[model samples]
Target: MSAGPSADDVPAPDPRLVADLRADLAAVGGDGYRVDAVTALLGLVADAALHREQPLAARRVVTAAVGAGDPLAALVGAFVLGLEVPSDVLATALPRCGLDGAGRLGLLEAVPGGRARARLELRPYAAVDAAGGADWWVASDLGETATGGPLRTDHVLGVGGASTTLARAVVREPVDRALDLGTGCGVQALHLRRHARSVVATDVSARALRVAALTLALDGGAGGDRPGEDGAAPGRGTVDLRRGSLLAPVAGEAFDLVVSNPPFVITPRTDGVPAYEYRDGGMVGDALVQHLVEDVGGVLAPGGTAQMLGNWEHRDGEPWTDRVGAWLDASGLDGWVVQRDLLDPAAYAETWVRDGGQREGAAFDALVGAWLDDLAGRRVDAVGLGLVVLRRPVDPSRPRLRRLEEVPGTGSGALGAHVADVLAAEEQLAGLDDAALARRHLVVAPDVTEERHARPGAADPEVVLLRQGGGFGRAVRVGTAVAGVVGACDGDLPLGVLVGAVAQLLGRPAEEVAAEVLPAARGLVADGLLRLA
Candidate 1:
């Protein structure tokens, strides 16, 4: 295996090589050739690793290629890990590797087979540049294409779905201090820098942190470099990078915001060994996620927020909400847990195991069996996956817990706004009474559109339809009673009183009207179209 450059022996990227790489990447017509060459190189190394069972040796070859001062090095690393690294696209990035003075190549090199490929991608630099420079780069496996094959346990992938979801979900308000825990490839940290005065990014894997730092430096995402003539530094955010598990590195410090996309895969290690670095949290069950949820409150300042994407087990005879609620309750933080998706045990096991490359045959079945057994042993029946938003309250009264089922039709960006509303309302609730609520004006949600249909053949040809604009475009029949209640919700009446008045107008029992309208009314409130008085 080839070795990397030693401290004294490492040479700077050759200026000519850097220029050639940049030109090649920028060259218009050579995209196919670049992708083919890079992917072929990755395949060759993967085959070699599989034949020899020496993963590190295979990785060394990729490192050498990147260290050769060619942009193709990083391309090869991304490709080997199943990331969509278009040669033509990355060619434009070659100049950056050399321009930013980012030293050291930290590539995402994965063993050729297992679930690893699904989770991370490898990258490498020609050399390690000094820290705190004006230029840096940080790349993650967000928006990368999936290679339609079985996942390898240690496969590092390029960008994909989970990465972007977490990125957009993070709170973007400006803050004095912020932390990106489990900062895989530094994606969250890079984003956090925009709003935070000071940002700290930490990860359990040294390799991940190294790549993250390099990505930030090369991409000018982390704040360090001076602004160019345009007044934009290549790297503008002041980010402090650390290597540690979860919150271990920043034990005593509290922050205004904390974000994480953790390794929450609940898979068991065979032979007492972890399957991958990118996805496995290395706990027996959901312990890792539980620990993160349970401990985050201690590190959050009063009124600070923690947002994360996590997976929780659904046990037989146990409601998913109750299980997640317990975590929030234990944390002593006001929180909202929304289960956006759920998977049956069999489906969940197959999805993750197949992600590791075990498909639906005997090998796959055995893996599934192991997963089922693990779940059964612990009485887990399903897997609940979604986002958790927690607010550390200044008052420290019992924390509020709101559980919501997934409304796939709703927009995620809107959900962020809803969270803000929930927090605001929670704070104002102390001063609010039924009479106060009665005086508030509520706007009908834009998403809720009312359509009046006229049927010429009917005795009373008019019908009102309440339609939701997103998701599946679900439509509900709204009788006059419902319509009257909605029309009267101009924020001037308490919801309870509005229901009573509408019932009286329609000559119906208030109890029956209340039963039907209250739920829908609350939904409107939660969706931000209505406000509690």
Candidate 2:
């Protein structure tokens, strides 16, 4: 309820308190105070559901759990579940660091009648990336679920859907140096450490950098230190936190990889509209995402990859690809964009207005009007929300890959590995001509299956669908010729031989079959449906 800490007055977390808190949490249960333990202790199914977003659902159980002298549950109840506890109970729970120490750490504040409430929200974070599954504690400002109101303008976000989406979308590859731009709470920076030898996390808000520093310290598997005067060393994998807007902090520095879940929300530049620093980049329309795409290349080393999430405006008659592709053309980076979802002006406005915790009332209506007017003035029809992957080619003279398409609901597993495969395929395909490609042996990926659909009485199938069981879960409809080529791919013979054999069976010229199937085969290879033997 106290308006949270300002940028300048942001309190540094005490290392002793953090250690005590970690030990206190570990005493309760394994996984370091997991959500399931709290839910099971509370015995409330409704409280366990994160989609509900009502933190008060487990109040009774939280109070009871705290009263029962469960230190982990007490901390979870007070900080995560957002409940007030008596000063004595809190002191008993965190005996190492009493209420005074907690107050100094900016975690909780004392209330009347010997009671105290948590100011900072803390919870266990679990992730499964290329390095396998891991757990850590993350601390950030209380959200609307706890505060029961709109988020503060400079709110530091926890592990939300957007951050999770970006975490999965990023291509995880081992590199010497990586950068996490707009590193809110340092989620991406943590992921970056799994592969990159060193990470540089930068943000515009000092408050956000403070929260990120706290997050990095709490999740201290790697060395938790800011970059040195000469940057990070080779094997230490330092997590360096910097304060600046966008790429200004990293100017004149080139990174091997850069990942961001940036502040890409488009907002009206009109007066009276609150610009949340975590979401809005203080730009007109979709320029923030554009600026990142265009300018991020400056900091990317040759052969470096930059993966980010963004929103783009689509005007009437103009395709979303053209609108977003223009930014890539200007960036001069090889780009792959996948527009996952699209929203009309009305729907987009409603979504953002509600995101700010504004209910459907007069003030909400006024804000919605401003959004609509801004869109109309710019001749915008809809907005596309998607993931972008850009790579600075080692050889700039070649024609760069510019693929813009719609790929939605790609499933829940880590897509980073898949993305890396696709990029490698792109690079391999770039070097191979048609004749060279035909000479290489190809094999259908293990997860791929072929399905034949036909009428009940028909012996011959009317349609064939090659579906992928892993990766992007894409289904490619193919003709019999291509299907025969795929079925014959046992890593036995080169693709040219298989095409020739199929051509002989189908009573067609070998050259004709080779020309037709070769293009489709290349497409399949790029998407990981087929692999080189």
TM-scores of all candidate predictions against the true structure: 0.70, 0.93
Q: Which stretches of candidate 1 lie over 4 Å from their true place?
A: 1-157, 221-224, 227-236, 272-274, 358-362, 408-414, 429-431, 451-479, 488-523
User: What would the TM-score be for candidate 1 when compared with the true structure?
Assistant: 0.70
| Model 2 stretches with alpha carbons more than 4 Å out | 42-44, 222-236
lDDT tens per residue, model 1, 477-496: 67777677887766565667
lDDT (10s digit) by residue, model 2, range 1-533: 22666665447666766667656665555545766666666676655554477555566667776777666666776787667777776776676667787777677888888778887787777788877776766777777777667778888888888898888878876899999999988788878877887789999988888877767655546444333211221123677889899999999999999999989998999998889878899888999999999999999999999999999999888888888899999999999998888899999999998888777889989999999999999899999998999999999998899999887774547888888888888888998999999999999988899999999999878999999877778899998889999999989999998999999999999998888899999999998899987
Model 2 global lDDT (CA atoms, 0 to 1): 0.81
TM-score, cand. 2: 0.93
lDDT of all the models against the reference? Answer: 0.59, 0.81
